[model samples]
Target: MATALATKPQVSAAEWEARQQLAACYRIFDMLGWSEMIYNHITVKVPDQEGAFLINPFGLHFSEINASNLVKIDIDGNTLDGSPHPVNRAGFVQHALFHRHLPDAHCIMHSHTTAGMAVSSVEGGLQPTNFYACNFAGQIAYHDFEGVTVRDEEGARLLANLGDKRVMLLRNHGILVMGQTLPEAFIKHWALQRACEIQVATASMGTPLLVPDAVVAVHQRDVHMAQVPGGPGSADFAAMVRLVDRIDTSWRE
Candidate 1:
């Protein structure tokens, strides 16, 4: 009789790298107080020819996520792999819209941080309060409140709100940031959330102060590149990943 063949499970080098970065992104969000009690999500596109992606298993707190704990799903929000926890279909709806439509959006991050939501609810959302906030000037998009984003029907509106911009404020909801690379996506998220905090604190002072002029804001945003040791692709996002690891290496395990 002919010997039977066994197909070995495959995990490419690219997939392993994506898994590490995706896991690191989760840890960073957890450390930053951006998590919403196991409600928010950060998803990354799978590597190679696969159009699927991975996200934190539902019901698990962000701090509890590990490289192996993420569940894979397709653009339609169907679970491609079996896991103990259910996937967040509501969260994935928005994520899938971006991954399917935005070619540059390799990683997508959504959060319900207090500051972020506060800004979103304000009459003026995400004001260009400082240099960090200027990058969003004339670029940020906002989606009107349409109840919870759980159905496939919500995808079109979400995509429309996102348009071509990589950053958005979900009106009366939360914040969303996407990037061509995982590191850039994570950094943009951090920047947006921090800017929201600053804006809220400044507004609380109840003082009318001068805001930077559009020219000044744009200049500052551009000049920030000089302060970084390396711009864009050369920045030390890997350092951020390592910092997360040092703080809690268990995420890797």
Candidate 2:
């Protein structure tokens, strides 16, 4: 942990703040039960540096992540800070494609939650059965599972499938949420996870689901309108940060 703190002097104030926000995001994911051991990743770009980003050290649990321990790297998967901990190669390969291709995607979160994977395996992806699901209507992308997304060539295919979309369902794998800000990505992941949970539970009952198209359209428009700068999600994210701080403040280290 001391070694992690040592790198703080090497970065700018903006990048340092980005690290803290990203670290808080990791702790928040742990608290929400979204982390998949040390396998999945949540990354945020360094402000004003194209192709440079911060990701969790590969072996540490999400709850163990902190602003100091986050690893800095470029789009080519090279660690810039020379940290003892290694970055997840697969995570870098997958997330870098989005960071390089989409300029607005400042934060990217990938997860393998039970409900997320369950919904990914189904025929229709993210059925608009509920309000949370409706907000993603016509806004989700799909990419067929190609093993573990390690190869360099697979990155292009993944980006092609995810063209201009904020959320994607990695078929037979998991879900990826992109955001212009950390809070937005976290909120999208929360909503998508809830939608998947609802789908799984409702499907288990063997009852036909009903999603009115007209109503879904209206709700989708309203959701878009509500997602302005410094909207409700920002407040919710601040509240979650306070909650995490109350629980363990160590993540802020």
Candidate 3:
């Protein structure tokens, strides 16, 4: 936490806004009990600045992340903001891979929550047994686990497995969700987590009821909930931001 804070005067309004949102996201995860000690990551592209992005410092816990302390780095993972914190090497292996190839993947988040990891390690990946899972139905992708994702070699396979889907369950590992914006990614993450949590809860209740593919299709195409003016999760993310702010305002630092 001794690292220098990127002050308002030091960065563009766009970049600073990105930093504050990313920091608030970290706090939101902490509030939702999504954080795992000091691990996992949530990153966002620097606004109007392609290739460069913001990430939490490697050593800080999610509760400790704040606007000024996030690290700025390129697609290759080299630190560009002169911050003293070291970017987690493993963070770049998969995150940077998507950032490089997926032009619209501006916000990427990865997590290792109990339900997420439990469903991932199960015989089959997420099933459409519940409402949230129905949202993804046949769209979730799976990647066979190859130990911790520290090698560059894993990026190519990850990219191939993900293709165009924004949500994936890393088999025997956890969840990864990408979005064109921070709120979009967060909403996807919320739905994925809920789907997995419900599936895990109902698995012991004998035969699990499944939503029909036809119904799932209808759910996916429902125009009533079309992208809000703020983006995919904009409205929900806004409410969440207000909640976290009520809990603690230090993330705005």
Candidate 4:
């Protein structure tokens, strides 16, 4: 309810690992320039908990975050981390709702990247202007911006928008990507952002562009399916985990 700074607490080894990965996700988001101040958040479910999620603490910039600084919270947005450092309430509204209702969602990443936002503002939203967009054709969802999601009443709409999809474009706002693992979420967000970037750039070119057919789009998704770490229907989450180490090994500490 209130934003305050608090000390990082000692967590069990397993919990610590989860914290580390989640924190690394924050760093990766920052590195990709997907962050919107300390506002946007990346959340992952605590491995063993139902209706409980882990997210970055408020006030700390993504670059300054380490594993120990991550906070745990319940579906109702209550901090379970035992720290006074507040969790972003809006983060709770979107993330907690996903974890609470979608059993397949273990990791959720939201961003305000410029290209993503630009596409969201477009009349048709994200179009299949390129190969990247084909991978998400008929697979993306959209949520209308309802101002800030600091209130609980917005949870239903958020859930409705996300439904059973793994990717969402927040109309007039930004983008959201959810998956069964951190890597899945990260990759989806990356692909979504890239798709948006391509769409915006192509529009700027003012040149007529050829679009891929649905059959090609389906094949593209299948090609990507093999890249998903945990197998079919799963994002290549393991690869993403490895990527964090490549980006910043300190996130593991």
Model 4, residue 116: what's the lDDT?
A: 86
Estimate candidate 3's alpha-carbon lDDT, on a 0 to 1 scale: 0.89
Query: Residue-wise lDDT of candidate 4 within 127-231, one digit each (tens)?
Result: 777877878878888888889878778878878777677888889989888887776677778778888888888888897465757666666757754563565
Specify the poorest-scoring 10-residue window by lDDT in model 3. 1-10
RMSD score of candidate 4 (Å): 3.2
The segments of candidate 1 whose C-alpha lies over 4 angstroms from its true place after superposition are 1-10, 208-212, 227-236
Q: What is candidate 2's lDDT per residue for 1-253, written digit by digit as tens?
A: 3233434437788998898899998999899988887889999999967779999998888888888889999999898888778888889999998898898889999999999999999898888887788878889999999898889999788888888888999999998999988888988998899999988988888874668889888887677676646753687788899999999987767
Error of 3 at 133 (Å): 0.4
Indicate whether candidate 1 or candidate 4 has the larger lDDT.
1
Tens digits of lDDT, candidate 1, 1-253: 1111112214677876777678777887887677788798999998774679988888888887777767778887777765455778777887888888888888898989998999999887987766657767767899988888887887787787777789999989888988888877877887788888888898888863545676755676676655456545335577777778788787765
TM-scores of all predicted structures: 0.89, 0.94, 0.95, 0.87
- Please tell me which model should have the higher TM-score, number 2 or number 4: 2
- Which RMSD does model 2 reach against the true structure? 2.1
On lDDT, the leading prediction is 3
Q: What is the per-residue lDDT of model 3 for residues 194-232, given as tens digits with 9 covering 90 to 100?
A: 988889889977889888888888888883376677668
lDDT of 2 at 15: 90
Most accurate candidate by TM-score: 3
Question: What's the C-alpha lDDT at position 152 in model 4?
Answer: 78
Clashes of 2: 0
Minimum summed lDDT over a 10-residue window in model 4 is located at 228-237
Which model, 1 or 4, shows the larger TM-score? 1
